[model samples]
Every structure is written in C-alpha cells, then in structure tokens.
Target: MIALPPELLPQLGEGLWHLFTVFLRVSAMVSLLPAFGERSIPTRVRFGIAVAFTMIVTPAVPALFAQPNLLAMVRLVLTEVLIGMALGLSLRLFVLALQTTGSIAAQATSLSQILGPAAADPVPAMGHLLTLAGLTVAVLLGLHVRVAQFLIHSYTFFPIGTAPLAQGLSQWGVQQIARSFGLAFALAMPFVIASLIYNLALGVINRAMPQLMVAFVGAPAITFAGLFLLFAGAPLILSVWSDALITFILNPLEPPR
Candidate 1:
C-alpha cells in the first residue's frame, strides 16, 4: 500500500471546514423557504437538499473559500449564514403577506375553522392555499434560476465574511419588510372586497327576516362564495405574486441602484 502525504492533511481539513461553512449558510436559507422549510417537509430531506445545494454552490464562489486563519474562517462562516438567512427570510416575508390575506379572507368567508400547515406557523385553510399558490407561482416563473442568481450576486454586495449585522440590517431591511405588506394587502384586495359585498347582502337579508337563522345560512353561503372567488381569481392572484417574488429576490440586499 502507498503511504499518504502527511502535510496534505491540514490543507484538506481547511477545505472541509470551508465547505462545512458553505453548507451551513445554504442550509439556513433553505430552512426558511416556503415549502422547503414547512413542517410537513421532513428534516432529513431538507438536510439532504441543503447539502446538495451547497455542493453545487461552493465551487462557483471560490472567493468565499479562500484560505484564512481559524478565527477568520469562523467569522466568514457566520457571516454567510446570517446573510443567507436574511435573504431567504426577506423572500419568505412576501409569503406571509399572502398568509395574512388568507387569514382575513377565511374569516370574512366564515371558513377560518379549516386549517393546515404552511410554514413554521399553522395557518387557516385559505391561508394555506394562498401560500401554496404563491410558491407555485414562484416555481412556474423560474424561481430556481432566480434563487441561484440571487445567491451568486450576494458575494458582491455582502462578500463572504463581512455581512452587516444589527445596525446595518435595520437600515437596509425595513423598507423591504414594509413593501412586502403592501404587496400582500393588494393581492388580497379582490377577495376582501368580495367578502364585504357578500356580508352587506347578508346583513340586508337578516334585517328583513328576523325569524330566519342567518348563522347557518350565512356560513355556507360565504364559504361557497369565497371558494368560487378563489377559483376565479387564482390565476390573477398568482400573476401578481410572481411579479412580487421576482422583485423580492432580485434586490434582496442593497437598495436597488
């Protein structure tokens, strides 16, 4: 048997450590994405996906894994993890806007009782549907390619070991968060308006027939109407969602030039 080279071991160890850091960063990002991070997704599967992604991404950003002392290396890894998480979370916030709309629509349609898993949080059935719709729109619009492009661009704005933390993050992240809310409310507006009309009609009906049980009649009617609206508007809703997702992913970090 041939003897192995002893000095090569340190170099190999350093490379492995750098790879590990990359994995951590990628894993953190994946762990927060809509379907990828949802509770229904098994942990082992997410881990495997994260590892595979890291393997693919590591080679592309060679500057990230350049040689450094142990302490500097640890800082680099931490920065990567922070920046990746921030980026993923920013995208995920838009999904929350959909979730918020869902919850409101569900309540308005009197279907809030139905519930499902959508993320780290539990959501009403309508909310869950909205979440799924948003994710589907993202995928159909070539989100995989966008996400890859976004990650590659990160090395430019944030670099490897110098991602901004507390002070810098607050200044940069607030506007994105506010925009997400604006987009979410706009997406839900149609359903919201529909619900208001339906409720107003119900109110008129109640005022006319005091003996009738509006509770039973209103519940089923609202639910059915909400479902119908959802089916009718899904395509349009998804179109807006896809556009918002593109905007979110394309400029996740620095203010757009």
Candidate 2:
C-alpha cells in the first residue's frame, strides 16, 4: 500500500467528517421512521438503510455539510438529531393517527380488545388491522424513496448546522398534534354516528318494551354494523391516511391542502 503525503490526511479527514455528519442526521431519522423505524426490524438493517440513504442524500446538499471545529461539530450534530427526530416524529404521528381512528371506531362499535395480540401495546383488533394495513400500503407506495426525498428537502426547514426556530417549531407542534387528533376523529366519524344511532334506537325500543334486555340485543347489532362498515370503508380510510402521510413527507411544514 502506498502512503499519501501527510498534508493530504487533513483533507481526507474533512471529507470523512462531512460524510459522518450527514450520516448522523440520516441515521437519526431512520431510527424513528414509521415502518423503517419499526421495532420488528433489526438495528443492523436500519443502520444499513441510513448509510445508504446518507450516500444518496449527501450529494444533493454538499455545501450544507462543511467542515467545522469541535464545538461547531457538536452543535451541528445536536441540531441534526433534533431535525431528524422532528421529521421522524411527524411521520410516526401519521401512523398513530390511524391507530387513534381505529381505537375510536372499535370502542364505538363495541369491538374493543377482541382478537388482537395483547403483547404488542394491547391495541384493539380493529386498531391492529388498520395500522397494519396503513403500514403495508405505505411500504408498497415506495416509502423508502419518499423518505430519502423528505430528508433531502428537510434542509429547507431545518438547515444544516443551524437549529430550528423554537417558536415556529412550537406552534407547528401544536398544529400537528391538533391536526392528528382531528383527522382521527374524522376517520372514525362514521362509526361514532352509527353507535349513536344504535344507542338511540335501543333506548326507544327499551322504553316501548320495558321487559326487553336492550343491552343484549344491541351488542350483536352494533358489532355487525361495525364489521360491515370496516369492510366497506377500509379502502377509503387507507387512501386518506396514505395521502396524508405522503403530503407530510413531501411538505411537512405546510398544512394539508
């Protein structure tokens, strides 16, 4: 092996340092990404994905990753981690939106805690189904490529070496949280309305026939209605969720159009 001149070593180190800095942001994002960041996947796989993504994204923003002193590097790393976590959390919240909707629907339809795996966060079966379906659809829609693009574009909002604006981020956080809950409620609205109607009709029937056991009569009817609604509306529900996630990835700072 031929040894390079001592002077070239500093340039090599600078290049490697730049790459490492980019890797920090990418790895941080991937570690908390939705399906990519799932607990089911191995850490090694996620690391590989982050490295591969860093390689792809570094070229797009070379000027952003300049060499810096130790103090600057520390600040930059911290900034990158925060930015990555923000991006990842944004996407993760999309999944949670579906979970919220499903839980609301299940509870409304009297189907909570039936047939879903108890070991994984104790979600209702309907919640598990919707979450799994949304994740699967996202993967099929080229989520990895979308993630790469998102990271590249994120510099627009959270530029390299610079921390995000705290006041703006705080407002954005509030908006995103409120929006998630609102979307969940919207998705579950049909079931809620159905539940209200079921209870109202049951009340009327029990009032007319005081001897009737309305709770027993209403349970099966509500459950069956919920199952049919799920069967009928799943495609629309998943499509809405997928569009929302993609919208956030493409333009996280903007509100949904």
Candidate 3:
C-alpha cells in the first residue's frame, strides 16, 4: 500500500472526522430502508452500503462540521442521525402499508394461512408475494437514486445540527400512520368486495338447493374465483401501491389532494 507523507495525515484525519458524522446519519437512514434494512443482510455489508451512501449524499449536503471540536462533533452526530432516521422512516411507512394491504387481501380471499410461519414476517403467501414484487419494482425503478435525492432535499427541511420540533414531528407522524392504513384499506377493498359477493351468492345457492352439498360445490368455486381475481388484479393492485409509494417518497412534504 502507498503511504501518504506525514504532513498529509492531519488533513486526512479532518476529512474523515466530517465523514464519520455524515456516516452516522446515512447509516441510520439506510437501516430503515426496505432492501437495505432487511435483517437477513449481514451487518458488515450494510455498513459498507452506509459508507457508500454517505459518499453519495455528502457532496450534495455539505458537512456542517467545518471546525468541530469533540462536543460540536458529538452534536452533529446526534442531529444528523435524528434527521436521517426521520427521512428513512417516512418511506418505511409505505412498505408497512404494502404489508398491511397484502395481509388484508389474503384474508379477504380466504388464502391467509398458507405457510404463514414460513415467512420472515409471518405473512400469508399472497401477502409475501405482493410485498416481494412491490419491493423488486421499487428497486428496478431506481430507489437508490431517489434516496440520494431525498437526502439532499432533507437538509432544507431539517437543517444541520438542529433539533426537530417535537409537537410538529408527532402530529406529522400521526398523519402518516393514518395515511398508511388508509392506503392499505384502499388497496384491499376490491378483494373485500369480491369476498362479500361470493359469500352472498353461496348463501343463496345453498338455500335454493338444500339437499345438495353446497359446501363441496361452493369451496372450489370461491377458491377458483379468488385465484382468478388475484391473477387478473395483482397487476393493478401492485401498480397502485407502487405508484403511491414512489409518489410519497419523492414528495414527502406535499399534502395529499
């Protein structure tokens, strides 16, 4: 390895000190991201990714630690981490919304218990499927690029080395949670309506043919209908979910119309 001259060491140390403060924020943010935050990923790999993301974000939002001593550096670390986590968590809510939608959809279609324990989050097969697909689509659509842009924009809302307003943050968080659940319900409404109709039809048919085995006939019919509905509607459901997620991530501060 090539060694730098002794005089350059102090300059290098200063740069690294600023970089480390930035690292605290970027790493916290990445820890909440969908793909980057998964528990299955190794800690070492995630740290490396945090380092890479720090590099991408640092140039855009210049470090505030220009002449930081120990106490100033500590404050920078705390403030940066808080801001990063706030930004990352806003996006993570959308992912949680997707999971909630999937679980509701699976339950509505009577497919909720297919190897539930096998999943990392213990979601049904359908829920797991949709979540995976949605995540893949997000990545392919360039989530990393969007994240870098988001980091740059965040500095405008949350300045360096400043504490966020507690009351304002709390209210915004409540609003976000409500919005997430509303989105989940909206996505699952179709399946829920289908289930209701299927049940009503089953009741009518059973009443009209009391002697016949309605359970035997209705089970397969409903199952087939559910499968067909999923096949036909999965694309639309995913499309709506993904679009909403991306839109919110790109425009976090925009009020929904």
Candidate 4:
C-alpha cells in the first residue's frame, strides 16, 4: 500500500477541496454549454467534458481559500453555480438566435411545417438545418479552444464566491435577449422581402385573371423561391452569425451595435 507523509495530508485535503469547488462551477456551465451541453449528448459524455474543462481551468484560476464554516461553503457553491450558469446562458443565446432566424425564414417562405417533427426541439426543417450548420461551423472554427479561454477569463469577470449585482445582471440579460431577436430578424430579412414581393405579384395576377387558380400557382412559386434563397443565402447568414457569436464571447458586456 502507498502512504503519504502525515504533514502532506492537510495540503492534499486543501487541494482536493479547491478542485471540488472549481468542478462545481465548471459542471454547471458545461450542462448548458453549446456542443458539449446539447440535449442529444449523453449525460456521461457531458460529465466527462466538464471534468476535462475543470482540469484546464483549475490551474489557470487562483485556488479558493479553505472555507471556515458549513454556511460559507454552501454560499460558495451557490454563488459559483450562479455565475457559471450566467456565462453558459450568455453563449447559448447565440444558438437560440440561429434557431429563431430559421423559424422566421421558414414561416415567411411557407416552409415552416416541413419535417417539423424530426428535430429534438420540434423546430422547422430550416431551423434544424441552420442550428446544425451553425454548430458545425462553430466547432470547425476551434470553438473548444475559445470556450476554454472564455471559462478561464470568467473568473476575472466574476470573482470566486461572489454573486453579480442583481440590477446589472438583469439589465445585461435584457440586452442579450433583445440582441438575439434583432439578429434573428436581421438574418431572416431576405426571406421576408421575398415573401412580400411574391404576395404582391400574386395579388396583381389574381386581380387580372379572376377566374384562374392563383393560389396553386403562387404556392409552388414561393416554395421554389424560398428554397433557392436558402441555398444561396445560408453561407452569408452563417458568416454573420459566427461573427456575432465570437464578438459576444470576447466581450459579453459590450452593448449591441
């Protein structure tokens, strides 16, 4: 059996405690992190990711001092979890923005119902596609490395065992939500414009030939235009979304431009 010197026991205990505290925060964040925290990923795999992140982050961050009492320890746990979740949700908003853009586009182009039930989130096919594509692009662009840096930097933004000021946090949350919706609408604007033009042209034709089945003709036309637009515009949309995501990660508190 292996044995450590008696004097080393206290140091070992303190080190373990520090690792545990860091893990509490990291695990909470990983539960909602993109790619790593997807509902499709198994819980065990996510847990393993959390541990890996903890190992990377724990060394960069200063070790937490030993807690003096049970109450202090409980407070530390709660605060760390809260801060971690805030960071995770901030990044998760980018994914939500992509999904929202797809839904808006699908609805505008009358493609909202196609394959709606296939996705885990019950989103339309366009939404599912955009979500998957955005995730893929992010992963391909070294999202894991950026996320590691983000996690390490979070300690500086939110110190250990300190809850953020509630008012500031609320204001920031509202701004992020607003920015997400704005980005979604901006990304889907092309589809919206196409829908508008199609409806206008359909109305003109219906007025000129009242006896014709305009609905049948217009429906297929709009669907084709929607699909073509998606094919041509997806690259640009994903590019813009990627830039926004990276900007947010680098400076979460910056006001949206």
Each model's TM-score, in the order given?
0.82, 0.94, 0.89, 0.97
State each model's CA lDDT, in order. 0.76, 0.86, 0.80, 0.90
lDDT of 3 by residue, 75-127 (tens): 77787888788877888888888888878887877878766655588777877
Judged by lDDT, which candidate is best? 4
| Tens digits of per-residue lDDT for model 4, 138-212 | 999999889989988888988788789999999999999999999999999999999999989999999999999
lDDT of 2: 0.86
Query: In model 4, which range of ten residues has the least summed lDDT?
Result: 60-69
- Misplaced by over 4 Å in model 3 are 1-13, 65-73, 210-213
Clashes of each: 0, 0, 0, 0
Question: Model 3: which ten-residue window has the lowest total lDDT?
Answer: 58-67
1 or 2, which is superior by lDDT?
A: 2
Instruction: Give lDDT tens digits, candidate 1, residues 1-257.
Output: 98769999877877787687667678888888765676678999989877877777777775433677888867777887888898778778878888887877777777777655544567788888878878877877777678767776776677667768688787677877787777767777877887888879878989999899887887777778889988998788878777767876777654622
Please report how far candidate 1 places residue 246 from its true position, in Å. 2.0
For candidate 3, the TM-score is: 0.89
What ranges in model 2 sit over 4 Å off? 5-8, 64-66, 116-119
Better of 2 and 4 by TM-score: 4
